[model samples]
Target: MSGTFSALNAATTALWAQRRALDVAGQNIANVNTEGYSRQRADMQAIGGSAVPAFYSTSDGIGGGVSVEQVTRIRDAFLEGRGHTEHANYARLSTEAGALEQVETAFREPGDQGIQSLLADVWDGWEAVTNGPDTDATRAQVLQQMEALVGGLHFASASLKAQWNQTRENLTVLVDDVNAAAASIADLNQAIQRGNQTSLPVNSLVDQRDLLVMKLADQAGASVRHGKDGMVDVIVGGVTLVGGTSATKLAVAGSLDLAGTGTSPVRVVTAVGGHTVRPDGTAAGQLAAMNGIFPSYQSDLDALAKDFADAVNGVHTTGAYDKLGNPGIDVFESADGSPINASNIRVAFDDPALIAASGLPGAANTDSSKADEIAQLRSKAGGPDATYRRLVVQLGVEAAVANRGVQIQQVITTQIDASRESVAGVNLDEEMTNMLSYQHAYAAAGRLVSTIDEMLDVLINRTGRVGL
Candidate 1:
């Protein structure tokens, strides 16, 4: 009777264990398509021998049936860490490539309507004046072309400023995103810690936390450190952004400027520690576009404008006389006393008669020497045209480099992501196979329980009745 009872007890335990395993399999199947879900496995172990003396035990002493030890999530911490690092790198490069492409669009190069073409027209106007220096139509054309040149400078300068402002705005928005993600991660950390205390399965919470951390990395190139009790710490630029259940927010400080100097260029800094965070991910890309790349182009444009105006005005003021028989005054002046940069340059002469096309006061109206001299300035080495061409070529090279960087990082990032998915991502086919396996085990265990019940009935009722 004792042996039969022990057998029935073992069979019952097997049934419950198998049922739990089936439940685990069903859970896995349900969340198979969920993002960031790590597959879970039920750990089963055979129960050990009983405390009964060997002499008193049955000859076929297999002890007890199976018992579930623990159900654990399947994940490799090393692989996940590697994936996060690669994700950050890929995001930074991608952001930089996108911003550089926008800067390229602002230039409007290789087209007729660009500043380069307008400069060429300015030179052509000078050449026309050389053919008919005294003609009112010729002088009017020169004046009109000069005004158009100035307008082009203003347009290009304004466009660059707009791009800078837009980049700063994007940085502010990204900073907000970074802060939100940090706070969410901190909240998840607290929840996960609570789950750990209660011995509850917190794999879902961990998945959500990881997803948020990845997003934060994209925004700010954050570093993650896993701790005991399922907590994770996030850091950016050597400053801790999230620790345990506490999160530090990021703030944008300063203004956007073209000089690349002053605290005017916006910066990302930790709110608690007041540590200045260097540009890392998308924020780094935006800052580079606003303070570094765009400003450089702006500076070049200003320099070109100043040099072109100086060159033309130098020749006009010193070498020619106006139709009023007065020596030429400066044909271009700074709107303010500051250097004649692109934004503030204007034509100094308002009267068409004041344009000095004749080399001498008493010279014939057709004395085109001064006009010829001005036209020849276009072909000078390192002049405005050459300088402008060099600037364009530099921009093209920078854009190409940025694009190539994005492509290379993308391939590397893809490979790392695939590796992570293999280890952590759920596969429906594998889950289905596991489901079938668990079902068969469950069925076998149920049969054992039924067999044990039948045998117990025989021992209890049939054995005593056979002799009666």
Candidate 2:
């Protein structure tokens, strides 16, 4: 009787174990299409051996039941962290390339009506003025071409500089996102640690934390470490970024000195919620944009402005009777005594007196030399129009390259994500198979229970008694 009951108990345990397995399989199937769902697996262990009568135990040992251990989500923290870093690098390169492209577009060089063409036309006008020195029409044509030359410069310079500033502003917004991501990562990290201590599955927190790390990396590159104590540590350039479950926020700070002369790199301090974080690699997309594009574009603009001023002044000083016939007055004067920026260039020539007086000869007081000065303007600075044309072409090329970079990165990121999903993602077909296997095992256990009852029924009624 005891042996029969023991068989029944063993069957019951097998049934319970299979039922649990079926439930878990059902859960996997239900969540198969869920985004960010890590595949779960159940751990099984055997219960301790059962006790039996001494005589029966001597002949055969009792079997132990199955026990459920842990159900864990399958994932690798290392791969997740690496995905984040790569995302940041991709973003950085793409952004820098984008801003540079915009800067390049400002100049439509080598075109028929570009700055180079304007210079040629202006020179042509000067030659005509040279032949007809007293024609009002010739002088007027010279003035019109001069305005065209300045107008193009104004348009190109202003457009490029504005684009540059816009990119910088975009960096500020990306930094805010970075800070918020970091904070959320830290919070999730702490929650996960606590959950681990209490023997609870940190599934939801892990998902949230991993997502944030990916986002943070996209904004700024940082590597993540999942510590044994259940805390997450983030590092950048080998410095502790988020110290063991504690978040450090990042922000965009510091004006572009455009004049910093230090090798230590004038850092843009990133502060968060009133707390400051030590800045790391400008490797992330937004920081890279700020680091590379703005400096180069601003320098180029400065160079162009200075060269424009010098070239015009050089030609004016060489020709006689080009000044407004006034003995001591110079042609151009800024309140700041510097060459005009994109903002101030148009304003610099707001007065026609400045434009009319910008001729040769300190006190010529004669329009006769205007034709001679126009002739000289071409001879002196006319050939250098190629320089401006080259600048515009470079901008267009850079923009094209940037666009290519973005496309390449998009492909790369997609491939990596697909690879990762293959390992960690749940599949409904597999889960359904597991459910069926467990369900069959459960039915087998039920059959054992039915068989045990039938044996007992036979013994109780048929074996003991027809006479009663």
Most TM-score-accurate candidate: 1
Tens-place lDDT digits, model 1, residues 83-201: 76777788777877776676667666877767888888988998998888777788888888889888888888888888787778788888988888889999999999999999887
Task: Please provide, for model 2 over 1-468, each residue's C-alpha lDDT reduced to its tens digit, 9 standing for 90 to 100.
Answer: 877877888788888888887877777777787777777777777665535457536423656667677777777665675567557657776767766656555655557656667667867776775665444566567667766766766776677556646655666676666667777777877788888899887876786677666666666677777687567787654445577767665555554443331232223343534343433323344444445555565556555555555555444444434334443223323446556653344323433223332244454243444445544554454334444545555666777787787789778877777767777778777887888788888899899999999998998879878777
What TM-score would every model get versus the actual structure?
0.93, 0.78
As a TM-score, model 1 comes out at 0.93
Clashes (backbone N, CA, C under 3 Å), per candidate, total 1, 11
lDDT on C-alpha atoms for all candidate structures: 0.82, 0.62
Q: How many steric clashes does model 1 contain?
A: 1
Worst 10 residues of 2 by lDDT: 258-267
Stretches of candidate 2 off by over 4 Å are 48-62, 108-133, 148-151, 256-283, 322-335, 340-343, 346-383, 400-404, 459-463, 466-468
Model 1 alpha-carbon drift over 4 Å, by segment? 51-61, 259-265
